[model samples]
Target chain A: MMDDIKELIEEGKFYFLNQKYNEALQYLNKALEKDPANIEVLYTIGIIYESINNPDKALEYFKKVIKIDPQHEDAIIHIHSISENQ
Target chain B: MERFVVIGLGRFGQSVAINLAKLNKNVIAIDKDPQKVEEIADFVFQAAACDATDEKNLRDLGLKNADVGVVSVGEDISSSILITLTLKEMGVKKIISKALSQVQGKVLIKVGADRVIYPERDMGERLAKRLSSPQLFDLIELTESHGILELLAPESFVGKRLDQLELRKKYDVTVIAVKRNVPKLKDDGSTSFKESMILSPGPDFEILLGDIMIILGKSKGLDKIKKVK
Candidate 1:
């Protein structure tokens, strides 16, 4: 199952790069189910959520990513952006 | 009431004169050099050679009667400040002075200049920025923290629609408009259609290939939004 989740994460990133946002979200979700604490996957999920106009969800994911990796530059930047803007 | 005077012909001076002229404002472009006045003759109602620091000549030009005045004496800091003070003494309604330094800026303001512009310093900063970030295309300052920008679409937003991207809600920005090159036909011979046209620009617009977008937002929000990609 862990092996499947890893494959799903790779597929999700590929879909994201291709701009297939919906397809990317499905794969990301599958990865999350297997390893819910995966910070990288959570950051990717935040990207998807922001892309889909879900600021609240995006902020939640970014917060989680920062909690796991406080020094994550992207998360720190986005958290400030989300809080200030929203 | 419509007439205005610009007393310098440097880059900053010329840009101001041209902008005012392009807006159909009645501008009088004056410079000490004959060549400077001649070059911008077409861009203004009148162009003449005049030393702006000369108080007598400023009064002769009816500085009090003119609606606005801009002192663009860019080369000589002393001359610019003296001209600004002279214009204020002439009781010009709006005296916009160009400053070469912070001290100059403060001096002009103290001399009763309605507004002070740091054109050289500002442009130097902008040029430095232009050299550093090749990815960043253009910037328009709305406030200290907020700005509008026309950036090359980021790698992350390549195929997303505005509604889907939800950038404004997430990042405090709105995509005001997009410029895309569609097949444009020239010299339409058909009477039915006199002009070539852009296609599929729906009211609910979708992002298309090679489209450059105009975005409005707080600068910090924009920086964050750019980072996610």
Candidate 2:
């Protein structure tokens, strides 16, 4: 099960780095379904939402990451920036 | 070679003084705080710490010969009004004052201010417009009735030729330019987005997704185009 999750995460990261946001999202979502408590997957999905100009969705995911790990520096910063712009 | 007097050393006043001086105009910057005056002394023609509301102090600064006076002390309406009045009485050709509210703006205009500016209100309006229409990049008012605007091409315009749309005849606006981001590879084989512009594209040019259209025409015409699906 862990190997499957790792493979899905690697594929998602590859698509994201290549700017194929939709494919990256599909893989990331599949990985999240397999391992619902993955903090990295949640943060990466938030970044994808932000890049696609959906700040509200981005903030929703970032807030969830903060709830799970209060010391998540990147998520905290993203939430603050998204809130300031809105 | 006209002289400009900026009465206030706040952010707005300092910016006005520095920009005027950069344009090779003679600028006199004044403020009640010595530190503020000293901070900008090197950049302006002259910097003085004096009470701007007092007509005697203005006269002592040789402001009577100034061609323009900008009063940015909007914190106190009384002082802003008094400084504007003193500048008007001093034979300054133009007096521009900052007003905190619409009522204060009216009062300033009534007291011989040639122009009254509301920095905060104007910024708020621009921010609201940009937030409401994410596609609108910029809007510049050229005159009371005309404006130049840059906005992302609406989805309907994609895959259509410019002439086929007959934008000028139908919407009464001219497409001055179109900007697009094309994918390019760098020397290191890294892919990047390169911005390209087609100035005054002819009839055969096809609109593409992610194109930014810069249009120039009456504000009403632009508003009409914006309403198109």
Q: Put down candidate 1 lDDT per residue, B120-149, tens digits, no spaces.
A: 677777768755754455778899998877
Residue pairs with colliding backbones in model 1 are none
Candidate 2, residues A1-86, lDDT tens digits: the string is: 88998888778877766656678789989999998888878887887766544567889889989999999887898899878766
Give the candidate number with the greatest TM-score.
2
Distance from true location, Cα of B131 in model 2, Å: 3.1
lDDT of 2 at B206: 86
lDDT of predicted model 2: 0.85
Question: Each model's C-alpha lDDT?
Answer: 0.74, 0.85
Provide the lDDT at B118 for model 1.
Answer: 79
Task: Itemize residue pairs with steric clashes in candidate 2.
Answer: none
Q: After superposition, how far is residue B218 of candidate 1 from its true place, in Å?
A: 6.5
* Model 1 agreement with the true structure over A1-86: per-residue lDDT tens digits: 87898798878877765556678789999999889889868988886665543567889999998888889887888779766544
Best by lDDT: 2
Error of 1 at B72 (Å): 0.9
The CAPRI category of model 2 is incorrect
